[model samples]
Target: MRSGGLKRLGLVSGLLAGALALSACSTVGGDQPQQAGQDGGQNASLATKLIMGTPNPPPLSEPVDTQIKRDCPPVDVLDGAAAFRAYATPGSADPFDIRYQASIADTARECSSLGVEAAIRVGVTGRVILGPKGSPGSFRLPLRIAVVDEKGVPVYSRMHPIDVTVPAGQTQADFPHIEDGVVVPIPANRFRGWKIMVGYDPSGATQTRASRAR
Candidate 1:
């Protein structure tokens, strides 16, 4: 009886030792620290393009839906908002924020080389959509549309304050903005390398004063 009891006690001790060793090996170190991601905080860049003159293509010849004609207009309406010439630094915003969204949907350029001047008429259209939290109200959208060279030097910049009126029970608005007769000098040649960049301008009188205090 004594010999049998000794054998059983030895077996139990060995099993406990093995279990403790396995636990120690699994958690050799404390909680592992999470490593930072490689990507720095960067927003997806806005769209850009070289302007080209192209008239609206001929409309579809066959359309027999009678209600479609009465319900929707054939073409989009454009507001007669003038684009100004100004220089202001671009600002960044959270893309995923449910505040507002604005973008330059289309641009067309008509280049002319008259007696001694080279100019172009740039047509810009911006669309605004209010998010879930946005309410119907009147707000001015500061659109910073500028032309930059290859080295990202601003050849021309204008802060067009677009007056947006979100109608009652509506969450979307569309308007066309134009900056006509923009003079693009030949000395700044490399026209293909030139880029038209458009983004929101977050600078204002209140913010300007606060920045100066700092």
Candidate 2:
């Protein structure tokens, strides 16, 4: 499994330690709510949803352009912006019909004095059954996953490029991706309203069209 680093997010003083320690938290499965607030208050849990087959999550508090600049990784060493633009463009021809989609199969969380840390581990799976041609060389699936509060404020977001290898004569692939160390501040009263979302990044062109349509 390939690993990508999370760009450290700015947080209030003193809470960073708790968030940092999340890297070593225990893992769990199933839908049971995990304990959050360190004060022994009512526990809270994160809700997970499928980005492709479900309703879209609330609009992001920050604009897509801003997110692209901060969370998106460079497509290449030079002409990085151009590379991203090209990659975001929906393919129009054969073999480009790779049905890309993902879901949050399981989740786990750990809490401490300063805040709560959750792991939004997911299974990114896809099949090339509809392709008019054969499998192309191995490629990276660019996935943008985010954790948002009830008011649509983002607690954590990252663009994880999962490398995929399609074996000869195979039509599908599965890549396990994890977004650990997701720091949610104390006062877990709102944890029940938080949600973890996974999906493709809105392409620059898509955003532009939406802007004009509005």
Candidate 3:
């Protein structure tokens, strides 16, 4: 009789432990999907849309004549006037398509005593659409970009060459590229607007020039 009682007690304890474990597991499983959904929501809120357009014609007659210059004294031509003319050439047999998009947010770190440290996340994608209607192309084009302040002063600049190939007769070739984030130490003084520009050369031209706006 005593042996039977001890056996029964052990069996009951084991069953209770199993039940508790199963309950804990079910609770954890139920919460996982909710957590994932919350993460997705956060990501959506953080994403900002960026739109790109050429406010004016390219600076130079040819893409090769385009130039980017930096750190000039105030009142100097930040970007040379002729530079625009160089890039302002007739559209290609297959027009080149370029787009610039950026996500801007306040950085956690402050640059000056006034808390001026700000960071902007920028992404640039360029595509060489072949044909008159901007159909897809088989060649990849190299590109250059710059970040300018509201006064038309260039604060940061970088170049990236992307290679993409589309089969002939395709309507479009999409080369989605992301530009690295830009962190600018804010000046103590108030400032105007900030702008970003991206350019491409489908003809394999490599010349570039830039100037700072006064």
Q: Name the best candidate (by lDDT).
A: 1
lDDT of 1 by residue, 65-145 (tens): 423212211111122122211212234233433455544343333344542444544554444667544667765666655
Ranking by TM-score: 1, 2, 3
**Residue 117 of candidate 3: its Cα lDDT?**
43
Write one digit per residue (lDDT tens) for candidate 3, span 1-214: 0111111111121111011110101011110112223343222111111111111212222222111111111111122110111122344222233221111110111111223544434333222333333334333344544566767777876655455565565533333444545555554343335544444433323432221121
**Which residue segments of model 1 deviate by more than 4 Å?**
1-97, 188-192, 204-214
RMSD of each: 27.2, 16.9, 24.6
Task: Decide which is better by lDDT, 2 or 3.
Answer: 2
Q: Of the pair 2 and 3, which is ahead by TM-score?
A: 2
lDDT of 2: 0.34
Cα-based TM-score, every candidate: 0.47, 0.42, 0.37
Global lDDT of model 3: 0.30
Model 1 scores a TM of 0.47
Tens-place lDDT digits, model 2, residues 161-199: 655555676544333444544454533453555555555
Please name the candidate that would achieve the greatest TM-score relative to the true structure: 1
lDDT of 1: 0.39
lDDT of each: 0.39, 0.34, 0.30
